[model samples]
Target chain A: MDKPLNCTIKNPVNLTLGDIKVDMLCGCKVVDITFPNIMSPEVGEIRFKNFYVATLTVKAKYRTENTPRHTGDQPKWKTCLKRVKLMPDPHSEAGSHDYISLTSRQFRCELSNITGLRLILHQPSPVWREFKLEELRLFRSAGGPKTSPLPTWLLEEPKAKVQKKTVQRVASSTPKGGEGGVPDLDGLSANLQQLWALAEEVSTSQTSQSLGRFEVDGCYDINLLAYT
Target chain B: MAAERRKAIPSTSDDNKPLDSDKQFLERTNVNAVVRDVLGKIIANRPEDPVTFLADYFEALVEEQSSLVQRALRVITMTHHSRPVFEVNVRDSYNLLSKHKVNKKLKGVNGSVYTELLQALCRNLPSSVTIKLVQKLECFEHEAVPYDVFRSSIFACCVLREYAFIAEQLFASLDIQKIGKADKALCDAVMDQLKTALGSSRNDVRRIIESSYNLAPEGLHQALERALSREQTQGVCTSEHFITEACDSFLAKVKKLK
Candidate 1:
């Protein structure tokens, strides 16, 4: 919605992409989407929800940091996907609100470090007045967290800091099956650990109370207060 | 009663002579005052089933007579009044839904519990809001329903009444971080659709209220349609402001359509 769209029918075309009057729109339009600082995702894939487009072409501008020539330079747009058929019928309500996912596997170029995306939408039907890509979102690869970068172990190259001969590996002894052995209790809190240690003693001393007898101390004859 | 208790305890020891220890036991127990309080309630309320009432009363008394710290905490948390208090809002509904037993993998809760929660929450809201909410629930009495069904129904209730503020609060409370931002984005997208639809034919709104509120006689739809057309003719901007105004006019028409 950063730039105004020249809609054919509506005087002031709706800027929001959430909902668009399908009948009002005519011919082809190229929409450039620049991500805000908060959600400027490194593109690994794209998902389109509730779309009714005949064909969609995708282009990406990757924010390259390694290259000195690309720094502070104009966006070098590269077409990653070309003329993918989203829906068989753009005019009909069939597949009008279908979800579509375009992964890096479908794209020709690597979708790393994508800061911006361009969608070329082509629809040539006058029958519908309300059509829109109800939602558009970018996501990182499934191998790592979507919002955060890859784990350090995965990203960083291996370094052989320790000498192999000096390294000592301690082998844990097998636990005894009998009552005395302290079993390995993983993920238990310190309080829970102490409780587990005391459980045997506690169970031995504990006794179930008499269900029928309701008494004050040992006295059966006593006045009881009314319940509120 | 203390004198009587002293006599009763002495009879268990020696027949004629009363022991000093038996007298002390009677004095220590404070039996008379407790009996008096119970008698006072029995006389006042005059419950039909005295034994059952006494059982419940004693059970509650035992619970209240816990440790001093526990009693203080109970006082802070529990309502002092005898009657249960009801809250009329989506947050309360959300809290109830969350606390209800659910199978995590299946994403479903007991359907009856869910319906009861919805009914309790919508008790004080407008009839139109409640009816729409009930219809949107789409949950059977005995079958289990997915978690999102409850969330969407609550949102529908808020939207029908144009309580956008409450809807936002509801969204914030029920939002699952694991699902990422898509759920919230979809919610916003749908709300935006409603706002946008208000400008055009208002067919969406008409479709929504096609099944009118109870007591909203026939021609209620026509009246609402006329109101919407009149509002449009007056040139109210078809944006966020118009949505609010349109909802108000729509509600007003519903009220007077009879």
Candidate 2:
């Protein structure tokens, strides 16, 4: 398996902040839209034509392998994977209760196939074939996002989870550069209330992002063009 | 001189105040000396008294270690201003820069200073990996090897926000081998008379063991003989049932050996 690139697409790629798209707390994205037909076997020269964009995620995934045990390197004759409880929320969708320290990392995700591929990055770096991919789609356009650049504020620590009470109290006192900087408090308050008052649908259903479930639906074996 | 010192206690009467002041001065002097000595040792001997250093370190955070209640009082009352100036004489008569940084944030609330400091001291605790490495060191396996009180105090943290790993590392420091010993008979007697630890709160786990006299998994008795055979080979002569039923006894033997 090829090294799957850890991509970070501000999950809600274009969080519509009034008129412009503001990348939320989500990480950068490397997206490519293609016919899903071709698998780039060759890490080739970057020509101007084969450019595409795909949504990205900065998920923690792992690839691992076992090594030949040199009886000398390890302790006496003992071999055990130290186990620890799964952290944070036990029922979190992150999966795996307590992760065991084996010899490798672990986590997996998928990306969808769409046309009009572009790289929405934390920093504007030209997207090329540097990402080691097991299987990847090609793109036609590397047209960057329409947003003005990620304002310096979004890159900071997890924004304080402002509650209604907190919003009321801190609406003024909150440190300058509050999440997404100068977030429309009125808009935020409304979204927050809507999120809280599920009333009926709380038990049965929610949108994929709402439920914290995401998959970039990638389709394969369709004729796709490559844009460097 | 010894007799004079003993007799002095009775005649001193009002000297209690002065004696306490002198004792405080002496302890303060001793700390400066110990730290200078410890710093020298930390440089020369290299990390010998890290835990002792850690203990003494966290101890000073205690406004008063007279007892739990007094320490608790300090927790809520020890003001931020006090913590910075708390280690006044720590400056000592010697040493260039006071390299030791004080946590100006430590708020002392009267009696709870000890507890609060204990919590804050976790900030300085050895990493879990570092602690494990130390535990594995032959030096740490000795008869006088110190237990980490920092690890012990975390049990008080129930919100369980963080530090669970630190909690486990602290609890595992309880040496069963140190508590159980060769003189099983004598150890059992003392253990029987003793009560549970002052801080050991009653919880479901305690209730489970108390209700059934079963401390481990159910249906362990049937496998005791086979289990004991393996355990005995490892120098632990214990049936599953015997060990569970007599944990206090086991701990006593280990403690006695120490």
Candidate of highest lDDT: 1
Candidate 2 off by > 4 Å: A5-13, A21-37, A40-228, B1-215, B219-258
Task: For model 1, report DockQ.
Answer: 0.01
TM-score of candidate 2's A chain against the true A chain: 0.15
Which stretch of 10 consecutive residues in model 1 chain B shows the poorest summed lDDT?
A: B211-220
Write model 1 residue lDDT over B1-258, tens digit each, in one string.
766666655355556664655446656686656667677655544566778667665665767545332332222222211112211223334443444444544333456666665565455555554554465453555465443444444333333433423333333322334232223232333233333323223344333232221102112222222333344333212223322432332232221100
In candidate 2, position B148 carries an lDDT of: 25
Give per-residue CA lDDT, model 2, range A1-228, as digits (tens).
132223322222432335554533322333332223333221111112111212122222111123325444432221111222222322232322222221112212222221122323232223322222223422222211212255323422123322332454444344334322121333322322222222111112212122111323333224453554
- In candidate 2, residue A15 scores what lDDT? 28
Please name the candidate that would achieve the greatest TM-score relative to the true structure: 1
Give Cα-based local distance difference scores for all models. Answer: 0.44, 0.27
Residue A166 displacement (Å), model 2: 49
Positional deviation of residue B4's Cα in model 2 after best superposition, in angstroms: 53
